[model samples]
Target: MTIIETAKMNGVDPLAYLADVLDRNHDHNISRLDELLPWIGHPLP
Candidate 1:
């Protein structure tokens, strides 16, 4: 499924999800990467 569809299925607003991921990607910890997945349904720590 497409990112928009996946994000929605996971209860995230598509645009906001993309924006947060893009914004946090550079500095986010690689070990905790799973936390960034759409299914997590929470903001970055």
Candidate 2:
């Protein structure tokens, strides 16, 4: 719920946000996790 709400607050599609984050998370650097936040506007690869 928090993820959905935060995405909405940032004007991002919640489903897209979650899907992208989950897909990237497997290979993303944990130390730079903030880059995955909805507000960061990380483009889907």
Candidate 3:
């Protein structure tokens, strides 16, 4: 829910952002998880 709201606020596609983050979560650095935020994600057009 928050993800959707935040993504909307940032003009991002929530589904794409969530998918990308989930795919990358394993290899992503825990300390930098903030970089993977939905609002900061690069969505496919």
Candidate 4:
């Protein structure tokens, strides 16, 4: 499960997190998935 807790703990709004990641994460590799994680913000390199 994607930890909604991470979103909360990072002070990121859950809806915003979902929208952001979903909108841009289509091409992301599984090993680099942390880039889209709630705590990481905006698909970091």
Candidate 5:
């Protein structure tokens, strides 16, 4: 199921649920790279 559907089934706000998931599992290296790519003018492959 899609994220919004899963969130509704679990009775949580979708955006909040997504944020929580990201907070719990996201890698800071990837996050920093994601933010930096645009500033570096290099598209990620």
Candidate 6:
């Protein structure tokens, strides 16, 4: 019933599962930005 148990039962990679969960709830949508920025780049002011 726990997250690890469920993920394991479904044969999902733990890291990938965590990433997908985080990505689903990501606050920013940089993909829509006009300019592609490096992952460490600060947002325009």
Report the number of the highest-lDDT candidate. 2
lDDT of 1 by residue, 1-45 (tens): 598899999788889998999999899999998988899876733
Each model's TM-score, in the order given?
A: 0.80, 0.91, 0.77, 0.64, 0.48, 0.46
Clashes of each: 0, 0, 0, 0, 0, 0
Model 3 ranges with Cα > 4 A deviation: 41-45
Q: Which wins on TM-score, candidate 2 or candidate 4?
A: 2
Clashing pairs in 5: none
Model 4, 3-33: lDDT tens per residue? 6677888888877787877877787788987
RMSD each, Å: 2.5, 1.2, 2.1, 3.6, 11.5, 11.3
Rank ordering of all candidates by TM-score, starting from the highest? 2, 1, 3, 4, 5, 6
Arranged by lDDT, best first: 2, 1, 3, 4, 5, 6
lDDT, candidate 6, equals 0.47
Model 6 C-alpha RMSD vs. true structure (Å) is 11.3
Model 5 poorest ten-residue lDDT run: 36-45
Clashing pairs in 1: none
Off by over 4 Å in 4: 43-45
> lDDT of candidate 2?
0.91
Span of 10 residues, lowest total lDDT, candidate 4? 36-45
Q: What's the lDDT of the predicted structure labeled candidate 5?
A: 0.50
Q: Where does model 5 exceed 4 Å of error? A: 27-45
Query: Which structure is stronger by lDDT: 1 or 6?
Result: 1
Model 4 TM-score is: 0.64
Better of 3 and 4 by lDDT: 3
